[model samples]
Target: MTLLSSCTRAARISAAVIALLACGSVLLQIGLNLLGGEPLAEALWRMSRFFTILTNLIIAATFAVVAGGRSVAPRWLLAMTAAIAGVGIVYHALLSHLLVQVGAEIIANHGVHTVVPILSVIWFAMFAPVDGLRWRDTWTVVIWPVLYCVYILARGSVTGMYPYPFIDANTLSPVQMAINIAGLTLFFLALGLLLVGMLRLRGRKSAN
Candidate 1:
């Protein structure tokens, strides 16, 4: 088999393994939380609050990249996945340190935030279908992050809980929260464009 095909197989298998690990970590945390007397619904809701969890789900779906052999996965989906992974990495590096975790929480936190993101970027480097990406689809990448911000903000407004400090509407003024959100939105847009450019450039080099 060609090197490209081998990398494709490797990426698929790696993605599946990472996905299973992520799911297992999440389940372990949930089980632990319940055993500690946390209410079932609240435990689930808290799990969903982390961008880490959502990004890992996107990484899981990327196994679809390998489903049809040489056929490419949807470009928009790949873009969103890469963007979220980027965001997750940034969160883990800079923000997650503010919170404390122990035992299973530590394992679950790193599994989804660190391990999954590293594996995803490696998969993109080794096997992502760059040829299927288009510059025009750059705007599509922000959709998921935008929706997530909205959902979290609205939920936090009602529940008096915010996942991240920067976007905490309860503490920050509207203008400050908007500024933070806008900054993050811009970050997502720039990251998406960067990924598109990198992939397109790699595609050109591969063609030659």
Candidate 2:
């Protein structure tokens, strides 16, 4: 097989592994929740939840990149994934006090050590081609947010836990919730565009 095809296969394989890991982690979280019987149950639950969230976030990006990144170029994906990750870092690092409390504790209780995002970092390097970045790569990173938001909404309604306070449509008016969602989506989209632009430039250079 050609190098490109091999890389694509590897990426899809990684995504499959990641999806399994993420989904399994969810079951593990449920177990931990049930195990609240143990003294360290909360901590375990938190750790499981953290890992689950982190992996799902990163793996979703991987799927997005793997499925779409090839349409353009590898470098475009690499650059965009990096940018998307940066946006995530900024969002988590600089969240407002209200946003954090608004249900943030639920997600925070999960093991949020430096390791959570580590799983995702590899996707950008391993899956994204070293050659060129493209507009499509940006769209791949977005899969995480879009899918995750839906998961959170559904799970929250079932579990009585909103991952973040801002997302709690239960208390907030639908308008307020919509506003928050729209605002956050825009921010993520902007980040994706920037990443794509950066990758596209990199691709242009490699060809010369």
lDDT of 1 by residue, 1-208 (tens): 2223534556657756766775676677788899999999989888788666676666555554453343434465456556656656677667876879888878877777777667666666656666666788777777777888998988887889887888888789999988988888888778777777877888789899
Q: How accurate is candidate 2 locally (lDDT)?
A: 0.52
**Total backbone collisions for each predicted model:** 0, 12
> RMSD to the native, candidate 2?
7.6
The residue-by-residue lDDT of candidate 2 on 16-115, one tens digit each, is: 5654554454455455556556556665545433323554445455454454434434543443444345434644565433343324334432322122
The 10-residue segment of model 2 with minimum total lDDT is 108-117
Give candidate 2 misplaced runs (Cα > 4 Å): 1-87, 95-127, 130-133
Candidate 2: how many backbone clashes? Answer: 12
TM-score of each: 0.84, 0.52
- The global Cα lDDT (0 to 1) of model 1 is 0.70
lDDT of each: 0.70, 0.52
